[model samples]
Target: MTPPTGTPRPAQAAEAPARGSRLRKATALGLAAGLAATGIALSTEMTAGAAAQGSLPAGTQLYKDPNSQVVRWVAAHPGDSRQPIIARRIASQPQAVWFSNYSPSTVTNDVKAVTTAAAAGGQVPVLAVYEIPNRDCGGASAGGAPDLASYDAWVRNFAAGLGSGQSIVILEPDSIALTTCLSAQQQSDRFASLSRAGAAIHAAAPHAKVYMDGGHSAWNSAPEQASRLRTAGILTSADGLFTNVSNFNTTANEVNFAKNVLAALGNPGNLHAVVDTSRNGNGPAGGGAWCDPSGRAIGAYPTTNTGDPAIDAFLWVKPPGEADGCAGPAGTFLPDVAYALASAGASDPTTPPPTTAPPTTTPPTTAPPTTAPPTTAPPTTAPPTTAPPTGAACSVSYKIASAWSGGFTTDVTVRNTGSAAVNGWSLKWAFPGDQQITSAWNAKTTQSGANVTATDLGYNAAVPVGGSTGFGFQGTGSNTASPTAFTLNGTVCTVS
Candidate 1:
């Protein structure tokens, strides 16, 4: 299904054609949830016993694939300018190795090679099994097993490689969530295969943890997703669900969305969630441009250290710098994007290096725009308006995602710190130096004088108490200083 925002879902591209193909040619295969309200907590009562069944055991050392695309690229270009940061930040991190090709003859051995190495090191390896029939709904990352029966057999071979040690499986991303092109019978058959796929894996590798897709928060509603998971046999088949696979939603929103989904599923004791923290540090590009829109950074490092019990781990399911099929062929690792993500995401507090995988998530290092004169400068900064005493207050974060000569782009996040949910919002801010907004997204935004006003679009109107919504814009002129003040629905907000 199309996301609520009608944005394109990020593509988890198919893996490389073979395991060692990248070492010779330096290529690899690669691959959102959201929260609704602010401070929404999962019902501990519902997930009380999940701790015992959720996540790989604490202190589990996640396996870092030595042959990942970044690793090979780093080795191949040791003296390149971007090599140092890419090696230190991304190549060293532990990311899932996708077995996306339908190579039945060698599939078992390929899976075994990875799991066995992890077992030798007493670490748990992550495997993304993406060969579902009609995967990606025939989109850019399309082509999987030709039929469901073939998929089931391939899955069994995949399970054979899991050894006796603990392993994690991100089973068939976009399989359950992106079924719009399938007929009812096609969906049923696919779901049945998924159910059997889980069973076959567990039967072969009892120590493996298999997670199905939960879609992201910006996509399906909790109840709707829960119903889909149920029909897919999530309750009895899989260990948990995964979110933000290749998307760029914030970690906070994914956590909130996962909890709500679990709550709707009646909080099964064995069901938890893992989120993809590969490229979401700066959140979405806004306006649903998921096809490798520029200016994204990496998110939280992969780890099981998430303090919340309902969340199993924050994983690097999508390899950083791998094109989302837009910037390059889906799985090719581009150094420019890799370097961009590393340099930019390095300073982010939410994105730390992983204990086992060095560190992958980094804050964007792109400088905010430098101050410059506008073509049509305004006379003066607008005076602040009186805030209505509706118990609605907010905090705003204004960030310059990228900048260039005479133009720049920004993302503005508005968080509700009020007692009540904001049904709708209008945010107003005055430019310190007449920075003119040429275009805007995710809201009806316009500028008059040095003042800019942005109101919510219908789908994203509500900002639940403690929840946030964001919008972005492309603008002309540059300004180092953020707007001195911001008013949300006429109530002044805490600016940062």
Candidate 2:
């Protein structure tokens, strides 16, 4: 999913293939499976537990792959300050690992290794097959096989790696949802490739459940997404659909949206859905804060225990704490952000909060900003120095809007208190405790250990004398003390 504002959309392509004869064969196999398909069978034994409506499904079985980056990090950094919380909140959970590279030669072996390990552990592996041409519309996660034939070849090899074990494949993200960016012919060819992909996977591993990308709750209307799913051969080529991968939308919202889309698809009660409940704990931050906005928390943990009959499971398609191309590169893991998300107790899995109030049960609408009177402060007359510049005279104020057990929301305002106008600014501070910023808005923010820098966006770069601009962030930690010192362009700002 695309970020709200200047954040670049992560490129979402990976490698797969298409051979005319093989495509025909795979498509035929998928069609046959669809005609003879019965709905998934539920195990008779269910673990008795009270799961939140859209949280992990009770009695559902999901596999936790041990090799995920977060899992490895927790093992290697057991002594780190953030390790304990991250290990408890994130590393322990199961998430899908993406195979985005187009390595035809090694793709099959890679798939086999994963599936083989999962089978030995009596678990089902979740695999994300992300290669598709022109993925992300040439955005940040871009790079796929050169053409359809190459993609077809890649898929065939990828499918071969399934090794007759239980697996779940999340087919290309944005491949269908973002098709409007493609020409009509491109769309048609892409759809065909997707169909071929599903067919190939099903043919290779009959036990593998394949889910096509359904965008997210906010992107396409049910009917529209359903139509696209049909055109992409979901019914004939795949088992079900998945949504909210790499995006933040409340699970409740995705549940409703997924059900509506399935209803629109008119499947005969066979198709189900999975939601990426990785980092939607506080839902979207509104105003298009898709790319790692502050104060966002981790959502429900991975589980097959979705209470809803129509929903299959809630999976962590996008691993928590991984940068979505803004804080870092698209998939680079950020420990502080991860810690903030995992520790955000706004929607604790044990006591999941209602995403929205009764009746609608959608994400709560963000409130309009309330204007506050300017604070009275003493002005400084320090001359602006270009080099070794002594600090610029400014005022900084911090406010905690909300707090939970491990999470809090803070807003910081900076005003030019000097006589001269400030052309550009950088606000810096350090957390007093283990606190980490998960998401931020109104500026470009980055964190290194406890220190953070919030740089002005173009529109907010210039602060005339007495003018002010502000940004907000959501963070996680037991201690949320206001940073004692604030700096603006090397000058210490008086805190209010």
Candidate 3:
């Protein structure tokens, strides 16, 4: 999922008059402290379920919609080297159907197609209703219905397609969280529209569950955000709020912040929330580096059984592999990034953990008798001419171009020290910790276990003696150390 274009502002100093706001502020502070201490604990609960049921949670009724861009990519590019990994890691997983376009003529039919299929399959489909006026504050993901009346008509058409089936509707991304840029009147109008949209969807499909947007934890203070949610009619218009859609905040932090927000709303009818755990395996990188930053890993697989009562489900709201504007055009699917996210070893059981063996004890051994041999004469014939070097002896240099909390971008240079040229080369290294490559350029890269291998692209394979070639990558981890060792064609290289 692409992050909103406008940057999140600091929390305003103006205090909310509601007593509930004061209580929520105090509770959120405590939860934030706990999140800081624990960080993100690796959980296998969701992974185990996905593996058993071919990527869907076992015994869960959430729909695994067959229509997704990644699924289509896999079908079209069967011969691409990255196809299998992308298919296994992302295409197989369930994600939301995003209706970003404003097509009044076909919107109803499009929504009906997905809901009808899922209903027949005895499952619930997730719909991301993103056509809000002035969406993303007229930034990158901008464009929605022209005005309030148009938006109301659009929502009506979209809801008509629900077909009385179970559906989870994500109202709009960045509509509430990024409202500081809007005027007071505009903000009020937007909130009213959201409330009406939720009511419209429910009227069409009584079984539908609508979750309004609540941005990520990093964007707004919990009390302020809770106040906004309450004003948006969260109590009567929707089931609950959803957080971290197309953002990188960790689940632990989002869960804590969400609970605080709900508590501030006085837990209206014991309302709960769902989290977008699409690409937050490593959590947010510091400094708001949101547009296609490198090093991000896919988070937990989508599952209805999220273990936490307040958290209804962990859904993949933003599909992996889609660029957030910088890597490619915004929303374009890049297979290289998809493969990197999949191979990052977050939930991959095929990646073996580092092992430790017991130390071995050696028995005593006697030294052989020292015997002095007679001197030998020089060889009669001259030594055969030394053979020419056959392969390149390469060395690699790594540098951190930029870094944030959970992710960083790096540049790697491969130099040939040998006398001969290398027609083809494969550079390999093993991460010292949980670091994983999320995106790469100038070369093709793959990962297994802690090891990463980058093969030269067709245009840059050959490296002449004393010449060099290079590639770049983005990965996730904090305080990442340089790779301990590097090898070229199985031969160890000197790291610098």
Candidate 4:
């Protein structure tokens, strides 16, 4: 999702992959759910070498040896504590998913929410701790615990939230790197609290993988950053290190720096590094504002395929498209930035980078076209539209996915509250006002002034026996409808 108009948070990618000719606009809705949107899954088990996502160049196999075996097994099966909170999993070198947001007070509930979805398989979800003391390190995205004592209590809750499920805890972001702004005693106190936080989480979820931030390769020297982690109990209690939590750094550079930090910390085996690939194609612009920073594209999403054994998955800890309140209010949704980031990931996940990850759900952008092209002679058989599914839980949902002037892209979500998925669907709407489609991309967007009908073609013609398909269009007019109706084949779901 794009950063809200003018905010500090990054702009997560959330749209469709590159179309041969027409690029279907994507809404930045799935950003909080980090896992790259599309890619081939790891199908083979490794003996001494491994193959990961395209984000990491092929031939760069993680050793299938002892240590890697454990990691590989963990990588092969991504466990989502809560699938609903985390909607999609991006299979990059280091496979990772982000949990959808939940209240800080209910930290454990959120953790359970994600792990429940994970079921098993050892899939690691990215978890962020914002209830820290002096969060944001007093920068653009600043919002932390009211005080150190409160923060310590919050950390304890956060640790308990793990709930036995495996997770990659991205400890209080910018907590250490940006601590200079604090007073001497305040810094020390915060560090001590951070140590306790790590201890608490490790105690609760031994299966979890906790990594302390290493800033970005560009921000701190390996030796310097490693020293901080070491002091923060990284070597003793935490798994290892994490880099680029909320910044831009290429896979190679981040890996290189992470390795250096590990070597410096002198705990390579115990310490593994992960990179944040929410928005880093172009890397840092000259100035570097951090939130929705421009010239950025898409970096690798959280994955476990780091070329080096010390590196972990490239997870998206930051919710893409959600503004980093700094630029505006810190946590508002922005559509344009969301579209840009989602589109970038669909095309280039290793470009502009960010630190975001959300829930898990199936992403079929790169799947075989569900609809047939228009070249065939079936005049009635128009191409399947690029409408996304929705309302699977709700009785009805209207998805106004994307837009560009005259026409806007759309989709629908239908809840199969009934015993079965609606097999056939037809969308009908009358013109309470004047709206017409000037041009259409993924749908056979046809209209009779206010009367608009959109239907899927080809394989999508019939929704799964228990599933639903969305019909979309690119139309023009004031989006005002006194009565917009929908019919699944012949059954009416929405009436005016």
TM-score of each: 0.63, 0.64, 0.64, 0.51
Show model 1 residue runs off by greater than 4 Å.
1-54, 346-496
TM-score of model number 2: 0.64
Model 2, position 284: C-alpha lDDT score: 75
For residues 1-496, write the lDDT of model 1, one tens digit per residue.
1110101111223323111011011111111122111112223321231222555676667898887778878889865656777777787788888777668887888888888899888778988887777776665566778888888888888888787789999887777767667776676677767877877777677778989878787777778677777766677678899988888889999999999999999999889999988878888764565655555788888888889889989998878877554334566666766766776574533345434443343322222111111101122233233454478778999988666677666788888998877766789888987588754544556688888888764445567788887766667775645787998877889986
Candidate topping lDDT: 1
Question: Residue 307 of candidate 4: its Cα lDDT?
Answer: 56
Q: Backbone clashes per model, in order?
A: 17, 28, 4, 96
lDDT of 2 by residue, 1-496 (tens): 3211111112122211110000000001022223213222221211111011222235645666676667777778755666766777777677776777667888888788778888887778788877787776665565667899999889989989897766888898778777545765576678767877887777777677888978787777777777777767776677788988877788999999998999998854658889988878788765545655556788887878777778888898777766665444456555656766775735444524323222222211221121111111111222232432333589998988767789776778898887777876778889889998766655556789999988754435577778788767667899988899988888888998
Task: Put the candidates in lDDT order, highest first.
Answer: 1, 2, 3, 4
Whole-model lDDT, model 4: 0.47
Better model by TM-score, 3 or 4? 3
Candidate 2 Cα lDDT to native = 0.66
Worst 10 residues of 4 by lDDT: 15-24
Ranking by TM-score: 2, 3, 1, 4
Give lDDT: candidate 4, residue 457. 35
Worst ten in a row by lDDT for model 1? 17-26
- lDDT of candidates 1 onward, in order: 0.68, 0.66, 0.64, 0.47
- Candidate 1, residue 116: the lDDT equals 84
